[model samples]
Target: MDRRHKPSNILPPGEKLPAATVDIDEKRQTVSATLPNGDTVEVLLYGATVTSWKNGGGKTENVWVSEKAIWDGSKPVRGGIPIVFPNFGPPIKDHATSALPQHGFARNVRWEFLGSEKSESGTSSVKLDFGLYSSALPAKFREAWPLDFGLVYSVTLSEEGLRTIMTVRNEGSSAFEFQFLLHTYLRVNDISQTTINGLGSETYIDKVLNATKHEQTTPSLSITGEVDRAYIGVKQDTTSVLEGGSPRFDVIRDNLSDTVVWNPWIEKAKGMGDFAPQDGYKNMLCVEVGAIDGWQKLEGGDAWEGGQLIKSLL
Candidate 1:
């Protein structure tokens, strides 16, 4: 009963307007929406990230970096979650050099419509803020990496769900390294009936290959197949649950140490094509809320923020 995208005037491809409809209600449930139509549907509660679970879908939503680590949303923006800053995954570029759009273009550009608010406890949420200052970069992006940044994307569609917050500002002048991740894409009803509860004794970093390789300590959890790993140095509150067979999801994260649970599930969504209900991935699951090492250096007037707030414990 959740599916929207009936409003159009133009803009579609990569998108840049012409897809509106957002509503949220918090009285006793039964009211939630996020209709941007590229596909961020009725949401139902807190289905925040629709795609870009970093790399697993590699370039579908384009936004996974590698000057060091922590960046995953690779390509068309085929989802609802992507915010990797400073140095989440790969990319230091000898302090700053390599720039081929390796996850640092502010979710691939087009965000500015700051006009919606109500959520500080005000209930019925709706706050939208998107900015990528620095004279609106795009001249091949200031000759490939020149610093001066500002990306603030705050999307809140309540009923106790879909609260994505990301703020990163290092408006230029020295100190500016990066790395961050929130690449979530969850929506399941199957996927082996899901199962992921707070990384039992965490510490992971095995991007399918090498990163000083590490991952062995296990307890009990399930996904299905072709999953990637990246749980490292985590400890604090930490609560992860994606159950199944009855609409369950509890992904709570704060300050986040690191965590990335993936699912290629079925031939990687058949090479993707807007990733329709195309098996949906047997349903879905991609619990990720990470932070890499130290990296996130922001000096110039300083400004670094974090995001991802989901809800729906039913």
Candidate 2:
């Protein structure tokens, strides 16, 4: 074995060591990292999506992915963390993003691998960066929304949890407005036993109810049927997903004001071609964090940043 890989007891005190080992599969267009503590994270260049995250000596998987999800870059991965940019859901007619497809093109295009950096704080952590520029977009997407912008997404993994941050910069002379979201799919043993906390007093827009607005009455929201609600202006930055009264995951957001809780349930789950096993809906929940309730306007030469930290409590 390499000397650096030897047991820590044989090394001198206070000596700096590598935090994690990263592997780049150029043919597959994927990057994976393994920390000394056995925590691991994997990212795909397509959409710069985080496809897998495992903690607790690699025995616990906190992120969810569909078995039938296409990996040929044909479509966005059904699960994991999909980036929503410039638009969310379907685009409004006659709007700036009207010509763009549903949820914009951020999750559809390929991103460049910027690189990876090990934490200098002497902690067992690593950060991977990916970049997407306006010039890198396909002709159809570039023509649909002719705005010069650049996005830098960073995914940091540590022994405690995983953190993802995105920086959006306007490279054009004209100002533009856009919507951004992190569609995070979390894994659970059973959706019926899962409850989301910290959204009790907030008001939300229920897309399933014909876009009706209502206040949340349940302190611990449980998924019984189809749900597609966007809780707006959430005051709490921290939300917890509990499985059978035990906290399974804690999501801490920064600069993200809206939270969308969704579960396709029975029929809707079957409708999605990429969703696997037909019953995959019962094993996952989307606790998406975003700023989709309103547009974020950025002037020329300005930049905006936001992110979230998802910690596994299981």
How would you encode candidate 2's per-residue C-alpha lDDT over 95-171 as one tens digit per residue?
89999999999999899989888754456778899999999899999999999999999898886688888889999
Top candidate by lDDT = 2
The reply for model 1, stretches above 4 Å from the true place, is: 1-84, 89-113, 117-123, 130-132, 135-150, 165-178, 182-203, 206-211, 216-229, 232-249, 252-309, 312-314
TM-score of each model, in listed order: 0.31, 0.94
Over the stretch 1-314, how does candidate 1's per-residue lDDT look in tens digits?
11121112122244233334444434421123343323232221122223322121121222221122112323434444655554455455655635535545555544454445433322333455555565776677556777778776655544444556667788777887777777766655677877776677677766656555665566546766767777776564444555553436565565556777776656776766556555666666667776666666679978766655665555
Model 1 Cα shift for residue 88 (angstroms): 3.5
The number of the candidate with the highest TM-score is: 2
